[model samples]
Target: MAVTSEPVLAIDVGGTRMKGSVVDAAGRELHGCTRPTPRADGPDAVVEAVVAFAADLTARAGGVAAAGIVVPGIVDEDSGTAVLSANLGWRDLPMRSVLEARLGVPLAFGQDVRAGGLAEVRLGAARGARDALFVPIGTGIGAAVVLDGRPVSGSGFAGEIGHLVVDAGGAACGCGLRGCLETVASAPAVARRYAARTGRATPVPEIAAAAGRGDDPAAVAVWAEAVDALAGVFATCATLLGPEIVVVGGGLAESGALLLDPLRAALDGRLSFQRRPRVVRAALGDRAGALGAGLMARERLQAGVGSAR
Candidate 1:
């Protein structure tokens, strides 16, 4: 088979599923697929699934120039290692080496949230911004901090803003912290808190809708708490990072103004002498990670070409 021209495979591994795509040089996805992450099957199985997914995309694309994979956790990008991922049950996994050996292709490995942030800055909501924050609040909350038009990995542990303590005595977090921002502001947390209060298991969007209608006190209260916690976190980030914009993504971001308006107000209220960032919705949606991975793969391909010359 003839090798595909300037096409690369991109994979974004999440706690629930893995998204794969074949993207061309222009950053257009030619093909894409999603598969269960098989977290219950163990971390090793997850790694195998990711490799297999890449191989499948390569075959479908008639072969790719390179591949990029991003996973959650403390990713040592310099060493191409998935240092730790509580959700995926991995630790010290040399994912890049393993995938390179398995697929016989160059691989670019990175942290999922950071990859999404890169996409946001380079191609989406935070484009052209010198400093920005990309926070995606889904089943979990994570952030990507971009400074001076570059994403800061901080040696692989920089952007775990979700674990930042917001409420000292609040809910317990999976990371063994109490009252972490994620426990209150994540999409899952919003649904869980509303369910606990109203004894009705509703999705985050439904809860936001109820709050918008002003018909359910429980929904309104839960949403308010999430907004307050998120605002506090953003205020702290703004004070420290001085990001010009905060691009909110993930499942909760779908709520649009229901989440952003109050969040902006609360964040503004908390700031005394800090740069007030424009809180906006993510433009790339769920595809940010995959596109970012594609960008990484293209970079790897270009590096290889340059080195060969």
Candidate 2:
């Protein structure tokens, strides 16, 4: 009798959507689905959606051995608590316990971007690098730090690099701070700044394209400000952590050389004693979070590490 292995359930919950998957041991996704996160309906609604989504994936997998879930915001992985999610409007929620109780299985829980960093190191762009940064810049900005081959959680407060102040007395941030890196460099910030400057609405890609051709002075200026802000942040990271590489993902990274080229140059110009990191694009795209969740579940299952009720 050939004993087949049971798959594991993986869910990556974001402010806007939840990605769920049934994954086999080899990191292959056997099945997958996405659902709106329903955060606007309130946090509890999002929780219910996740529970239902996980149950559906488990059922489709014919019973999963375990599950892993990752979410945005401040996640205390050791304590299995979601400390805070500004976007999701929740704080100090016992996420792992809640899910484990409903799912009736051992579960692994973590921060979404940290999970993405792990997936990158294990299976994506940052492979073979002991120290790296996986930064996903989209609706918001966040960083995942890998040090000595391990992702740093910092008791759920470690990776808020977006809140790092780059421009003193500059634009306000949703985090209630002024001059945050996110204020100047996030995807929306780029578009918003351009729109404010020109009174014309444009997407980031179009802006980057215009900037690339040097045709639109506004695009060039906006793109330069974003790039400069990012360089400032990355320069700080270089001096503080000296990561060997940086994997840039999310919406802004789609700009490719228009972003990375100037970023590398700016970062290099700032470095004298610090080892400059090789900045590159993330390989996994939007699926990185889900794949990371799967990797976490599979690794936990293999190591017999889980949150059991």
Query: What TM-score would every model get versus the actual structure?
Result: 0.93, 0.95
Please give the CA lDDT of all the candidate structures.
0.88, 0.88
lDDT tens digits, residue span 152-231, model 2: 99889998989999999999888898999998999999999999999999989999999999999999999999999999
Cα shift from native, residue 266, model 2 (Å): 0.7
Once model 2 is optimally superposed onto the true structure by TM-score, how far is the C-alpha of residue 60 displaced, in angstroms?
Answer: 0.6
lDDT of model 2 at position 128 = 94
In model 2, the worst 10-residue window by lDDT is 300-309
- List where candidate 2 sits over 4 angstroms from the true fold: 1-5, 306-309
Question: How many clashing residue pairs, candidate 2?
Answer: 0
Show pairs that collide, candidate 2. Answer: none
Off by over 4 Å in 1: 1-5, 305-309
lDDT of 2 at 260: 96
Positional deviation of 195 in candidate 1, in angstroms? 2.6
Over all chains combined, what TM-score does candidate 2 have? 0.95
Write model 1 residue lDDT over 1-309, tens digit each, in one string.
223357989999989989999998778899999999999999889888887888788999998888889988899877788889888999988888888889888888898888999999999998899899999998888899999987888778898999999899899888898999999988888888998998898978989998988899999999999999999999989989999999999999999999898899899899998888999999999999989888888777777633210
